[model samples]
Target: MSAKRICIEKDKKTSDDDKVQKVVINSLDYDSLAQIFMLLPVPERIDIEGVCVKWKEACQLSCLPKEINEIHLFFESLLDQKQTRSMRMHGSSYEASRELSAEVLYTIFCTCKNLKHLDIVHCRNDVAEIPLEKWISFQNLQYLAISCNMTPDLADTIVKYCKNLKHLRINNRHHIINTALKTLTELENLECLILLNCIKLNKESIIAISNNCKKLKRLEISIRSIYDPPSSLSDLDEISKLQYLEHLKLCIGKSLKDSTIIAIANNCKNLKSLEIAGCSAITETALVALTKLDNLQKLDVSFLHITDSFISKLKGLKELHCDFCEQLTEAGFIQLIKNNPDLKEISVLGTDSITIDLVIAADQATKHRTNGIILHIRKYDLELTQAFKSIIKSQWLVVK
Candidate 1:
């Protein structure tokens, strides 16, 4: 081959390589690249963080959807030694291999500037040691779910800094006293609050929340202590002030009375779902008051003093849970199904009087009205007949 021919061929090959590289680099603009990254699954997006400097920078951009603003910090080590080394090489201290430290959490908060929701679960008790002042920087946080024991000071800091917070779920098994709840009263814009197994929650704290956070729409409070008096009933007067409340679940001790239910029905007319489980003080009178609530769709009177007569009056009830109500009889159960044609789900578990025949009658009555119905009766009821057992096993029948 001639020298000129060989040189020309080499130049042509080099020119083609340059064109390919340029096309790949300039194919998508910065915003387009960030949008594509946002569409990727969590694991794939994390993978892109280690691809190169450009990808890691793209991941930090605010072009991602608001749904992805949530960050779940898991305490358990999930990364291998090799992965940890790679993260360090990329200058990222957010290690998945070791237990999350306060410094690492702060780094995450800084990187995710647009972070609105954060869930810190299965974290060590030492997490409380992290200064609340550090969290002041994350002022845009709108929702926070923490399983750790939060101190009054920390709670105060959260209410002070996270002014835009709308939803909060604190599953602290430790004693959460009134001081922390009083601090929460400062959050006037708070909408949804879920307090599960908070041992020290009392009437005073509940009243503070009710008086201050009038904008609250949904609330779920479950007190775990056995000795705490039913003082929460008196606090219901305070809760009655929240006319904007739509959904409420009170799984406290037997303090609720007819007046309490009447107060809720009269004031919170917007209430659509209500769960008063373990309120043994409630009776038929309360049910009569509840019947006035035209918007009430779901009712949970489990472990309460309710009978078949009271169940018949719930006109708009779509879901009724009367588990462990021994007074409910088969005749009344059938009457209930006939009366509330809109009823979609019914739970009569632990009721000894509900027989297989009654369930069959109830099912037949509602089957044609709607596509289907869900009945959660006692398991022993199914043992009376094989036909009933087969019906339960088949997908056609929905039982729990």
Candidate 2:
């Protein structure tokens, strides 16, 4: 056999199409190898432990080929296992002793240029300061999620490197300011941005994001506080600039007004999905404006005060979630069943006032159709939390 054919056959046995289809990488095994496995599309098909063991053996035996693009080996754990060089770690939770070092992370970035997605969740071990010169290693990275203990400087370093990033989710417990968000503006291709439990992002940061991330299509924001004197919901104007936006989630626990909701409905006309949970300012006015949006398919207006009039107007809605809407009693719910013939899923997690009779009324209103109804409620009624569930079970019998 020819030399080339023999080499090809040997590599072919390991690179079988099926094996390539089933590769999963988990952290408990070779953390570095598992990361590399994540770069593969078929990581879900293969056994995660098996892939890690294989990579561990490959690294230990120094058997890794230089041209291997499918496998990513981030040896930060290995570097920590054997301290080589100093690496500056920036996250809030820094447990990696001077022994683990940042060289491993640096080395991985340098080698894995094809990394398309990167998730650094709750792992921040920076031993010494690494120069920015090494930051441009992971240029192809597209999806990046850094949560729990995000570092501001580290976030800048990542944005500088991953300029082509599409989805960015960062949760900074240390309280990041407008600077970090401004830095993210450079990622022109960013599509999905999530800032969950971030204590520092105020209205200014929100405005900056609206002005800069023009291409953003999906956003999840959790603001610490909203003014009680009923600050005008003018920040939505910034959101309106994002014409291509499809999904938006706003968790602002402040006194909101009807004008704010109207402003949002008018501006974010392209919104296919919307979630406004725990915003006490919203009322039937907001709900009324929302129904006018012909494109809205899924809506979650939980923990808000909506009356029977608003419930009756949602005839065009497909999926509706109204959990903990204390004011939404059986009268409003029955109105929803009677008015919204196209309704598919209804979630009433804490609307305890709704009884079994109301459920029957709802099912009857729907022409006794059981195929399209999926209700989520509690199992018992003794606890305050169980009311919604009991109501759902009682309603289920009526549907049949």
TM-score of every candidate: 0.71, 0.66
The lDDT, on a scale of 0 to 1, for candidate 1 is: 0.69
lDDT of 2: 0.61
The segments of candidate 2 whose C-alpha lies over 4 angstroms from its true place after superposition are 1-107, 124-131, 148-156, 226-233, 255-257, 365-400
Residues 184-290, model 1: lDDT tens digits: 77886799988888656667687787888888999887876533465445666677788888999988666566777788888999999999988777777766888
lDDT to native, each model: 0.69, 0.61
> Candidate 1 regions off by >4 Å?
1-68, 73-106, 225-233, 370-386, 389-397
Best by lDDT: 1
